[model samples]
Target: MADNNNYRDTTHQSDLSISITPAKAGVGLLFAGGALTMHRILCLSALLMGLFSAVGVYAADAQQSEPVDPGIEGSAIDKSAKEKSDSGGSSFAVWESKYFASSPDNTGPAVEQPIEFPHFRHAGDHDKGGMEINCMYCHTYARRSLVAGIPPVQKCVGCHQSIESVRDKPRIKKLFEYWDAKKAIPWKKVHDLPDFVRFSHERHIQRFIFQLNRPVQEVCGYCHGDVKTMTVARRQKLLSMGFCVTCHEVKHPVTAEGGTPIGDQAYWYSMRKPIIDASGIIKAQGPNDCSVCHK
Candidate 1:
């Protein structure tokens, strides 16, 4: 009996030490499973990151070493011109605001010319630190060509050769440098039109200005603003088709007594569309012909 009781006690102690409660066993199993799952997820994430990094490095290296396609480089200007010519000229000549120029180039709205050519000083009052120079004298081609050509350095040196007062001035000194080198001043072109649009200075000069015998300022002010005041030139006109069309549609009244003026250029633009003879009868007239502008 003693031996049996001792055996029972030993068995009971072993059970107490080895056997776990149901809640504790379940918690242990859950912790172990969670640990295994987290380990798998972390290993997978590391592998994916390595693959992505290698791909990114390879892509960067390929991009830096590769040459761009050759055909894309030279086709831009040609394509642009072809489109414009095909369209038979768009009325919106200077569409982009940043592209517009009056007197061109520089960081801001005002461009510092190679020589700081002061329009205000040259164009303003003679008594007020001004020479009051005539614009046509400098822009000789304004009366003749589509381009109002920049005056040659020789033209500038002509008068400047005798003027002793401002010879050492920095702007004047720079002028002398170009003159000495016999190089063009590389004057920036202010007014630039697109490839398709064709504007004739001769036609406008002959038709509206010379025919009407108007003031030079009023005549040029149709496109160029009152440049007499501005030190640096700026584009004032919109130069759009609508603005031009409005000008064409408006008439200049006859200034003399007992006189009737012709009603704008649009009236006479047609080819016998509204035919009228000198004897008392008036016919239809208007100037909305596309061919007149777009050729």
Candidate 2:
């Protein structure tokens, strides 16, 4: 006997469907008495043919109605939504800009920091008459630790002491007070993630910039926005689990539709390696398990 699992039923979304059963058709035909005219048999045959044709067409339409792609749709990124923003404008970029547009963290005009540290002054450019300081200089522990350690008051003092460029500024006055007090500067957290998720700056930085040797902007731009423009730091992306998952998949993407990484000459991706602390016993492999993040 044929397996029931192999049988295809085409009864979806139809009020009156054509179900063909060999035994029933045979029995119904057999019951036709000898009094039945030849025209009646021909008419019945035509009706059956039409029903079969309808079933075939219905099946075809069902398949085309929905598409399944193991490589594209299965990823954390939404393929259908992505297609909508493919034209010159980036869908992810568009979403990132407005993700926290109206939140408390985002002040419509500007972010009010304890000290009005201008990112544009430090990370901007020589053309803008800005110092264009390297981010790592202030965020020293970025590549080596989970939390990108904030620059201490002394870091600011060390420069302002001699530079005296903006020495008399009120914010600079606040900096000197903290230095004199011998206390940690109370900088507010900007990119605060949920307590459940464990993010590693070491792993990401090592992979993208160290291993791949990609540019700093591309590496930093992955999560932090274009800080060169903003005077105060603010979040650019949603920073949700889905956002992290989508980026991770895209970075080392092997199953993308084009069989290539989702990057272009205009903006390329950073490639980083996983560090395994095996107590000098074995190399550590980056985790892909639920407990790794949740715990």
Candidate 3:
């Protein structure tokens, strides 16, 4: 009886110990799970903060890079006054007259020797040769770079290597010598805009040719004139500030309805186009303040 009682006591103690062990393990597992969950929360919060900071930095950078718009009110008035001043009594003939002579002394019977480059003989449909090459072929850097670079003599000799049998072509032969010596030809600039104006061939070509779906030749013809027909180039137009402003005005004309001039309306309509409000109502923006261009 004593042995049986001892065995029963021992079995009861083992069962009690097993139940307590499970409870303790459950508590420990719950604590570990809570800690893991807290860590995940902290990591997620840090990730969100990092993303927010990055976005704020990008927004600030974008704002700094963007170009400031000068107001339209003063710009419109200035442009209007300029037009009136230019056209009030100034004759076109007077404007066309040369201000400076070729020589400083103004002597030698005014050697106004026109370079009569036979475009017909060089490029036109003649039996000898009529190479229908692109204008950018000669002015190679027109598309890719800021300045339209004039081709050196090496570019000419690439084709003239076989045509050495031509008669009395001293200029062509000189080009060969320059090519052999690897020297650049000194070509005079024909179309010279003021240094202040930031005119870029690349930007114009990218906009008109690539974006606006215009032909390259037609776009280039605006500034270069008919390059295909010209062997010796000349400035075809007087590219003045007024000229640019006039074109801008035409494209975005002022449309006033009341006694007060809708200067802001005209400005926005001209500056921002297809991206404007569908209702065609011009949103007021900064005026053509002096700092816009002068700066």
Best by TM-score: 2
lDDT of 2 by residue, 101-136 (tens): 555554233446788778888888789867778777
Q: What digit string (tens of lDDT, one per residue) describes model 1 on residues 228-278?
A: 776666556656654454344222111123223356544454321333334
Which 10 residues in a row give candidate 3 its minimum summed lDDT?
1-10
List ranges where model 3 is wrong by over 4 Å: 1-129, 164-168, 252-295
Clash tally, candidates in order: 2, 6, 6
Estimate every model's Cα lDDT from 0 to 1.
0.52, 0.55, 0.47
Model 2: residues with Cα > 4 Å off, grouped in runs? 1-91, 99-112, 253-287
List TM-scores for all candidates, in order: 0.50, 0.57, 0.46
Which of 1 and 3 is ahead in lDDT?
A: 1
Off-target runs (Cα >4 Å) in candidate 1 are: 1-109, 252-287
* Pairs in clash, predicted candidate 3: 70-287, 71-286, 71-287, 71-288, 72-287, 72-288
Extract clashing residue pairs from model 1: 266-286, 266-287
Candidate 1's TM-score: 0.50
